[model samples]
Target: MFLERYHSIQDNKVLISARQGSLFAKEVAGDFNPIHNPDERRFCVPGDLLFALLVAHFGLSRKMTFHFRSLLGDSVPLTFREDDDGMIRVYDDRDKVYIEVEREGESTRDQSIIEHLIRSYVAESGKNFPHTLKPLMESQGVMFNPDRPMIMYQSMNLSLTTLDAPEPELELGQATLVPDGKRGNVTLDYRLMSRGKEAGLVSKKLVVSGLRDYDPNTMDAVVEQFYRLKEKAWD
Candidate 1:
């Protein structure tokens, strides 16, 4: 599987290196979040990578919800366990849960379907920063602190009407942001389509911290720096 190179399985435990996490964030998901930088002091593996790994391991169910508990660091040994009640947990040796998954209905292990959904969803997710979140923040007259902007994935829920699509694509639907003082919650809704037919719906939630009054010029500069980092990494 394509995900094998991004993570390693040893003795029933999964391990992800800093380099591997960084590569998957930048190269595969097109996510340029500074937290995913290998050399950064606050480096953390991208939550999307963990979500992908879960699907890769357990297969995609008709309905699934993923809740992120903690930030995963590089080289952490993780154990994935599924209970009889359809709850899947990914924890470390210390038994600190990093992610919790709830799955229901039928599932499929078809590689083509899984790969297509993973790529499309992550690609759409990678555009969350300037593409989706920017306008949503602007609408609320709020923006993340330019110097120390922080956006954390909270949870994602997926409900599929059918999983028969061989190659489904994810499309952005309605997105909303609700602010409370200095913090804000963002909900991104997406539509899953295959051959022009609706197959599923997905909702992803994120928490933005240190929000301030929206300043277009500052936000633009911040976005520019983000692209510059991506370019530097690619070069």
Candidate 2:
């Protein structure tokens, strides 16, 4: 899996490097968040990377909720342990938990199904800044700082009434932005699609801080820069 390349499995613990996390964010998730930059002072691993890893290792669950408690730095070793009650925790050597996950219902080890879900969800999420956030911010009369944008992934939850199908996809649902001074909370509601029907719904939250008045020129440059980075990677 592409995820394994970003984190090393050693002694039953997964170790992530700055370079690996940065690449995964930009290349795989198409997320250009500055905090994920390898050279950033406060560089941190992408929650999407951790989410992909969890599904890759533990398989996809019908109903799952993931809560991120802390930011994980480069070269940090994480241990994922599953309890008897089906609770999962990603922690450090100090046992300080970074992520807590609770899964219920049936699970599937089908790699194809899992990979599709990961790709679709991340692609849908990567569209947040431009396709989703632009209109959202306009409605609220607030936007992110174009020069030094900061969007933090808080947590995500998904629930499915039943997982009786094999194919899984993601459909964008309602999105709302709540303003709190210079920071805004972005809640994206989406659904899991299977066999041309709604299989589950997912609610993902993000924190956008350091907001400012909308500037079309700067935001245009920012959007262009993101695609340029992704395109260069493909080259």
Number of the predicted model whose lDDT against the real structure is largest: 1
Candidates in order have lDDT scores of: 0.91, 0.84
Query: Candidate 1, which segments miss by more than 4 Å at Cα?
Result: none
> Per-residue lDDT for 180-233 in model 1, tens only?
899999998999988899998999999999999999999899899999998998
The candidate 1 region of ten consecutive residues with least summed lDDT is: 163-172
Q: What C-alpha RMSD separates each model from the true structure?
A: 1.2, 2.1
Quality of model 2 by C-alpha lDDT: 0.84
Q: Where is model 2 more than 4 Å wrong at Cα?
A: 83-86, 164-167
Residue pairs in steric clash, candidate 1?
Answer: none
How do all models score by TM-score?
Answer: 0.96, 0.89
lDDT of 2 by residue, 1-235 (tens): 7677788988888998999998888777788777788889989998888888898889888889988888899988889889777689898999988888988888887777788788878777777877888889888888887767778778899887665545677778799999999999999998888889888899998888998887777777888987787677678
How large an RMSD does model 2 have? 2.1
What TM-score does candidate 2 reach? 0.89
